[model samples]
Target: MQSQPVLLTAGPRHELPVTWQLSGHARRLVSVAVAGLLIAVITRRPEFVGLAAPALLLLLPGRGRQPDHLGIEIATPAGQVTEGSQAAVGVRISGQGAGQVRLRLHPGNWISLAGESPGEDGWFNFRFVPGRWGARQLGTLEVVIFDRWRLAACRVLTSLPPVICYPEPARLGSLVVLSKLPARLGEHTSRRPGEGVEFAGVREFVPGDRQRRINWPATTRRGTLQLNTFTAERAQTTVILMDISVDVGAAGRSSADLAVRAAAGTAAAYLAARDRVGLISYGKHLRWIAPAAGRRQAERISYLIAAGAGPPYPLEMLGSLAGDILPPGALVIVFSPLLTLRLIESLRALRERGFAAVVVDVLTAQPGTGHGRYRATADLARRIWRMEQEAIRFSLREIGIPVVHWDGQSALDEPLAPFTRRQVVSR
Candidate 1:
């Protein structure tokens, strides 16, 4: 692999000076010499002095050579990659040193390295695969150079730059149809009749009815002018609202992670259908991307999902979203754990604003009581929490919103399958 000209930074690398130290082989030989000399003097034996003579001669620094300058460059894979994919990293060491160069890599979280050993030409090439999404560190790397006589060596250590990994999208066979669709060209069939390929029904032709749309069979049977009508193919604006306020469950299977994965999948599916899709992430702060239709929009939403982290603040309600944040008549699909009361109020507010919504409950785990003196208190709290969660679901249903549960074990589209037939309506 050709090495790029970027240098690795341990920290403030330019400001610090490189230092050299005795190699392990040299240190061991010196220790042996010292011990042998001390034992010979204590036992008054001249044979011990002979044993230390070879060690002392080998430790002589006359033949040791030091490089005038040492440098390192690493070439990492450019651009963003999806999770569970492999990328190559190249390490190149250069300088004037008549010695053996060695490289060592320490893998970091979510990253695994392969073929860590260097080649005969002293270039360390490694292939790494990221296991999870988000910005993750590649690892810490160390390069060691030993002198020709193996007396002294110099070591350079630095950390590799972080790589951005996008989550692997889940498979979604179909999307939930919205109650209302925007007046724009798209792939979905709308209830409104207009110029489209799918035939809706036949109606009596009026004065301005086009001749090409006239239904010959219906016109002959009715003995009057008749024309075929078709449903208008219009796109609907879909906004994916992610409630990242609180995350539950284990690391990869956390509610926040599942929400992100669902967001990516849903965005991809809608974008493929030529529907305008947007994203709204509400935690301590509100972040949103305006609705847009294209492959580039899918990438933008994926990047945001991977990098966005909601900040913490005091609990408060998100009363209503502005028109720009959520376009008029847009279908709002919320991915949340439903743990915060403030978020529940926001869903209610969405209904009041005349927006249709579907909520996918991403909470995978429930609270449990452990065996202890305070088990009674713990059990009571657990029951109350469960009751509160149930109440939230029931309240959403009463307000004309559908709450579907996803445990992360089933396909994301499974919970959403019901909405495909029954559209989410605003009351």
Candidate 2:
């Protein structure tokens, strides 16, 4: 027995505005024509009344009905992608009476998708470019199917899959400039010790001595011992302290975005160098991720940066950070614009605590001209801004904490060179 094939489909839903029924240009035109025809009929012009009937019919709200049911299915690539890479996302729409519907996707910024009509089903494919790395809640797809004559418009909201875009990790060499600094702990020693690569001591070769570390010439000459020694490689912990304070003027760039990128870049570099990495973000509230090693730590930090914005919790929060955020004995790298007094105080406090704190200032190089009724006011503001920055730099230097100022215009590595040099010398 042959079986009939069943089709998978959805019904059309209506989203027409109530006023669309009798309160538009069409309605106005109908009222005018009806009045004119009634006047003619009173004037004994019966033929004119018949002519008006046709016009009245045209003015009546058209019989376009909303779709009975509607559904939108979105398709996207699995997992997260590095920044700048493109991902494919498709939306499939199905419903009865969807043929003449006009559909639009919301949040056109996040994903780039085009709308299409595939017979009874409407489909769209999007090429998404994630501006920054993190989990993004791409809101629902909005389908607006209107009645005939465009009088009434019906809207359908369908949930779409959420997408996460991970921050792009910079290459090792690109971030090596930052790593030129000596490891905070376990640095290689110049002189060889017991169980090391360099030749530390040569005694008569013990029976159990491995041939690999044996000095044959020494063994022959001394008739006693030969062995090589090497120092053990040490690992250090790097804590990236990001200032998310709204007061930190990023100039044109968003303070939050700049902080996130800096944290990501710095953390990735530390992890790649076999150093443990930790993150602490302070703004209105504090967010901390304990120090750890490996790719997973980097991922965890990236997720935090991506998902975070503005003040941490309380909206009215202000000032710099409290002392409880950082792990003891970790090298703290603070990335901030240093625009506020509170932030400066916080950095100073960290340095006081014996933490090797380095400040990466993300301030603007060019302060553009301001517009206002008072040129004097603009000039004063500029002067105040410059003075504040200089004071912050001076304060940090006095405390022996190096401040590497990064003007958003140039590569971070160049400005970081001096700090790296200092770190090497200090180590």
Candidate 3:
């Protein structure tokens, strides 16, 4: 997606209350100096007159001045940035007068910030680099205020609302097409005689054979009429099922990241191949899109994935969702790092219902060891965890389902290359 300003604000902004405070005991100094001066004059002693200097300056009217109305205008020129890219954040304080002003920006975990402090002119532009994916909101910005005397600070929380940070999809060119094709006109050759570019076997002239398909040479050689046949090219429907049950592995490089990236790439690749695509996201809730084809489908998939970057549903109705929306023989690709018996049952149900299904396993590596002093025990635990993961793989393979791992290091090759669709059996 092209990056644009997710938010922009300029011109006269609503003003914040202008509050002032005493600097270095200014009130005490002034009161003491005046009392001393009166005492000195009444007591006929001018020696204490020097004490009046500290109070006189502070007591002067308007010496510590404040702006009539403090206002801030923030403009995020590149308010929307792709993940792992940088943009500029522009901040201009309107009522910046005297003293010193510093922008106290609390950047979110999804961004790394660095920039020079705003000067007396109150204009600060900084580079904002986005880290992880999502429409992450920008952090809060607080303006630290210091009077001319350099004592007593008043923090004015300006109105620089959080803007969305768009996360770009990973580079996905193609997918290993192995699912069974339904009867439709598309790019994929069905290999049966219908309408397509590739030629199949030939036969003697049939009742419905077109004159253009007749092989003149073959007809003359055979001393009879002959006709040509070609395989039918058809589009396939691919459904991307995102299982946001949980995130695993390390922070920043978690399984959720891998799943989301892979899902996006897979959708893009399928769409490019002229395949009908749809999405079913199960993250705390089930959201779905029926089979469709077009640029709008890709955009909808991206938005759905970004919006569902959260925990999965507490219930186990993912199978129901799949059964309702998926047609027979549609390739169902599930992107997830989570595995449960309920999910396994769902997969079994899909296969039972004649759906072509595969699992894109997002968790590539093992989890980190726990923090403890029991070294031998930790080693044993790691071994057991690996065994459990191996069991999951074994079970999936038993059901004729292939689990492809996305390491997030390179493009995911044809995961379904070595696999075939399971034959549907009637109960």
For model 3 the local lDDT of residue 53 reads 65
Q: Candidate 2: count the clashes.
A: 18
The better-scoring model by lDDT among 1 and 2 is 1
Please identify model 3 stretches exceeding 4 Å from their true place: 1-15, 21-68, 73-80, 95-104, 114-125, 144-154, 163-168, 201-228, 309-314, 322-324, 367-373, 414-427
Encode model 1's per-residue lDDT on 228-276: one tens digit a residue.
Answer: 9999988889999888879888888888878888888889999999999
lDDT for model 3, please: 0.69
The 0-to-1 C-alpha lDDT of every candidate, in the order given, reads: 0.79, 0.60, 0.69
Q: Is candidate 1 or candidate 3 better by TM-score?
A: 1
| lDDT tens per residue, model 3, 148-193 | 6655455776545554554456566545454356777788767568
TM-score of 2: 0.68
How accurate locally is residue 269 in candidate 1, as Cα lDDT from 0 to 100? 92
- Give the clashing residue pairs of candidate 3, or none: 186-234, 186-235, 284-312, 284-313
How far residue 104's Cα lies from its native spot in candidate 1, in Å, is 2.1
Q: Summing lDDT over every window of 10 consecutive residues in candidate 1, give the lowest-scoring window.
A: 7-16
